[model samples]
Target: MTKSVGALTVRTDPTLKEVVVDGKDMSVYVFAKDTKPGVSSCDGECATQWPPVPAADAEAAKGLNQELLGSITRADGTAQLTLAGKPLYYFAKDTMPGDVKGQGVNDTWYASAPDGWKAGVKRQALGVLDHPKLGKILQDKNGRTLYLFTKDEPWR
Candidate 1:
């Protein structure tokens, strides 16, 4: 599989660990238009702005699940690599290795997490909130409101 994205590597951002190209800080992304896992819809001009991650027959970096790595033929007849059924890509505007300028674009694209997921959308616990009467309230790490429970101890 000679992939332009090179060997996929997992890099940890200060706040979150994510998957990146072998030597670039630019995170991989998946397009919402993709019909299914291992499929891609970003072609032509769309591909120009969001370059698909190339697939290589070579193995992924150590510690990465090989089963998660696969390739799919694009409309252009070239094989693009996919992670967990999602075609990977890089944002064209991202000029530097560490740039994630394409994290969220048009609400349709998102950075790829190390676990082959949309990076920033995953739920994370920020910290424990002390409630004088209710005890602790769990909150999203990103400051989003997360419903914990009701007075009857039922999950909200």
Candidate 2:
């Protein structure tokens, strides 16, 4: 169960908790960010580094400010959480609380608006490099820009 203070509510999950950063207690939200639109922008071995954060039990987050939360479908048919219509995500490199090593990472990965990284947060987001192209980022190593490997159907 979550507790609220005034217009702000503390989001609680077994995995997320309230921690102080710069002396302010902010709720840590877990989700993905958009490199662009429609088509996802991460792929290849890079995907292993910043794997998209999936909703644990899509149904687990029902009701509770339905207006503030939602999801968008990815090209891979997976749902990404949307807060105020923007998809949310977490950086795999953020190994511990208060580590925003992913913010402004490569001009690709970003902290989701409205419910992500708090002020004074430091992020090194490098996942945007992995998502398949929604538009087109510059070429990476191997002279490749964007790539995705189709799973053997029955898919998986």
Candidate 3:
């Protein structure tokens, strides 16, 4: 019998927003320690807990960018799938398809976004607040709304 190919896709989780998942809907993750593109730092015991997604026969799902999908040779000489240059992994504790127990683990592991960013991570350092008149506005970390003074001259 011919083996079926697996696919990678994006799904919206209540806590993780949009996360990249494997063909089985299992959440995929990235390691912050993996600072280099096309390389992986997760090995040995680390690999046992967070298994790398094999590159063989893996494809991007419909509506997903196929260009972002690639592969890298691991230390063991095996092929591991990569997204936007970052290696992908499966959390051992995530027994079910939608289990994201691996998110924020040790602050080093995170669910991957479609664009290969850490899913659910705040992109900006600023915060957001609801305004009665303006509807919504950006705020500082201290809860102060930010505004620009048009009359103020630009610094030289």
Candidate 4:
């Protein structure tokens, strides 16, 4: 259970950079399977491992848009906090405030960005290269290849 009502804030994670976290600094997450707003698919054993963040008394911290803060009723009839309509959660393994043990888990879980997007996964705005044998490939600004996995879905 949540100890007390807290504000949602952004923090710079070592790997994720800017990610949303509870006031206590515990990292929050968004499940890719949760495709609809005001809804959550994580329950039972899933809820046990990734607990839903309670919606009660949640507010956006400084620099975060309050308008994006919202809540959704879970299947269990409890209010879960949301960011831009995506449900927020806390990984059970994340004992410390900054722990992000759930990031990229099964390629379905990701730390939520401030705008309710996936954090840590940076998409290069430009830089595509053509290889003599490989044809065209995406690359980062620094010319590093951006390998996209076939199973990865776009996070909108």
Candidates in order have lDDT scores of: 0.67, 0.40, 0.81, 0.81
Candidate 4's residue-wise lDDT over 36-154, tens digit each? 64679898999999999998989998656787787888887888988767888889999998899999999999998776667898755766543433556676643456886888778
Two-way lDDT contest, 2 vs 3, winner: 3
Ranking by lDDT: 3, 4, 1, 2
Q: How many residue pairs clash in each candidate?
A: 7, 20, 0, 0
Clash pairs for candidate 4? none
User: Which residues of candidate 1, in runs, are more than 4 Å off?
Assistant: 1-3, 124-156
Models 1 onward score TM values of 0.69, 0.43, 0.76, 0.76
Error of 1 at 94 (Å): 1.0
lDDT of 3 by residue, 3-55 (tens): 23388888989987889887888888989999875689999999999999888
lDDT of 2 by residue, 72-110 (tens): 676667765544444544566776645656655665554
Model 4 ranges off by over 4 Å: 124-156
lDDT of 1 by residue, 1-156 (tens): 443555667776665456455544467787767866446877888988998877765346854566667778987788787766667888889887877778779988887764455666755556443332354556566433368445665554
Q: Candidate 1: deviation at residue 41, Å?
A: 1.4
Q: Provide the global lDDT of candidate 1 against the true structure.
A: 0.67
